[model samples]
Target: MRIRFDNTWIADSEQAILLHEPGHYPVAYLPIEHVEEGVLLPTDRITTHRDLGATRWFTVAGPGRRGERAAWTHTDLPEHASVLAGHVAFAWRAMDGFYEEDERILGHAADNYHRVDIRSSSRHLVVRAAGTTIADTTSPVVLYESGFAPHWYVPRTDVDETALTATQTSTFCPCKGIAGYYSVAGIPDAAWFYRDAFPEAARIDDLVSFEPDKIDVFLDGKQLGVEPGQTVIAHGLDRGLQPDEIAHRDDSGLHNTEGQQ
Candidate 1:
């Protein structure tokens, strides 16, 4: 993984390690040698990773941009986890972004266990929020993603536009493009649709999916229960960063061994 801040390459390495922290999802880590000089300033803040003990924080500065406690390093760890001895991982949301080769890695470093499979379903699907029908369709598209509920995507035509109120809040999925928001009469962000989905997820092009927690979703008259691993966990990196969060850092030359080695 290669990280850039303020347009300056903070670190680039083929040895970057992708870690799955208990509370946090996928996080990218690179060896200290891969980091640029003066980029990481040791900080006072410390955190404890569920598995990795005694994690230390740092202030990563790039050009005029400085992130308080933006990066962390596991200062002490068991011998089995010594591979991360001299490694540092930045907060995906705090840093500008990540990349593999020249392509950007959205959300976080890719997780082998995480995947999205979109399938066409012919079963009758119904969405309701606060006793008001949100959407009903027989041509629903089912998005089966690892660790999430089977999201039933209904065609825009079958949805009742009168019951949906548009909201400005939007989120991005690395698998899907920007997801637009919709609110029901008494619910907040009850539904969401990807107006312009990424090519990989074009199947759900203009279909909308209701949050099962906020609204009731049924398939063929059966109420859909939350899957074993379904969750509403916060994906901070998925929320697009504000312009004020970006800063450039270009200074002393720091070389990297970046290709897949």
Candidate 2:
């Protein structure tokens, strides 16, 4: 893993630890020794991590750019969290970019537990809105991702394109890339599609998925509905996310009942 800022490499480490706490996205913590010399300047700002204890902040400096309180480390870690004692974590939005090898990683640190599986299904899938059949297809792509409900994506050829009105709303998924929305029968953001997804999720590229709560979706003659508590609020650049950080973001889908740090 490597971090870049101000067109300079700030940190590069092959032994970085990924912390996956509840609610929040995975965060990468690298050894302080792997960070470039003089790039981290300690700051007086200090915060507390519920489990990790006292957290010290640092200003990340590179060339002519500086991110105030952009880096942090837990100074008084609990015994069980000792593995992160000598590690430092950078704020996702504060840096220019994070990379694995030559490819750039977006949204947040990739969660080892997170998985995206795409499968082609022959089951009949149908979508209706305002008493009109907007989409009907026998060949649909099923997208199963970690911690989310399965989304059925239909090819454009099977959809009634005229019934879809493009909307300005857009959301970004670290794994799937940017998702543009469409309104159906005057319903706002009732459908979404990924025109240019990340390489790993390319199978669903240019495919459309509808919101079950906003429209009537049926699969194999059975009405489809999202399970309770499965709906997620979209996270996008409007939330002050940087371009690189915009690639992946923490959505409200994950529950943070334990108040993890």
Candidate 3:
């Protein structure tokens, strides 16, 4: 893995540790020795981790840029967490990019436990909003993702195009590229589709999925509803994400599912 910031490579390591915490994405912690010389400048700021102990902050410096308090290390780790003693984790959003070899990793570090599976199904699925039929299909693809309910995606040909209006909203997923939103039947962001998903999620490309809470969705004659606490907030500037970095669409049209399981 490699970290780039300020148009410079700050760190690269082949033995980075991926630390998973509750209710959060995994973080990549690289050995302190792998980081470029003079890139991490110690700061007076300090914080504490519930399990890892006292954390020391640092200002990450590059050729002509500096990210204040963008890197951290556990100074007083518990005996059980001693493996992280000589490592530091850079604030993911603070860095320009994190890469596995030449391919860039978006959203966050790839979680080993997170999985996305796509399966073709012939289940009848229908979507409705404002008393108008938005989509209907029997050839839907079901996407089963870790920690999320199954999402049935329908081909655009089977959807009522007049009911959908492209919206200005966009979201990024590390496992499944970027998702573009659409307003359906006057409901804002009631539907979404991945025009150009990453390799792992290429099967549902250009397929639309409606929001269960904002619209009526039915699968196999059974009405579908949003699972408790299943709403996902879009990643935006507040999370330090910029459009140019994560919203670039791929036009290769490859449906390879060989990466990021």
User: How far is each candidate from the true structure, as Cα RMSD in Å?
Assistant: 6.2, 7.4, 4.9
lDDT of 3 by residue, 137-191 (tens): 9999999998899999999999999999999998777677778999988899999
| Number of the candidate with higher TM-score, 2 or 3 | 3
- lDDT for 241 in candidate 1 is 33
In terms of TM-score, which candidate is stronger, 1 or 3?
3
Best by the TM-score measure: 3
Residue 111 in candidate 1 has what lDDT? Answer: 76
Clashing pairs in 2: 107-248
Cα TM-score per model:
0.79, 0.88, 0.89
* TM-score (C-alpha, index-matched) for candidate 1: 0.79
Q: Flag regions of model 2 displaced more than 4 Å.
A: 231-261
- Pairs in steric clash, model 3: none
Total clashing pairs for each candidate: 3, 1, 0
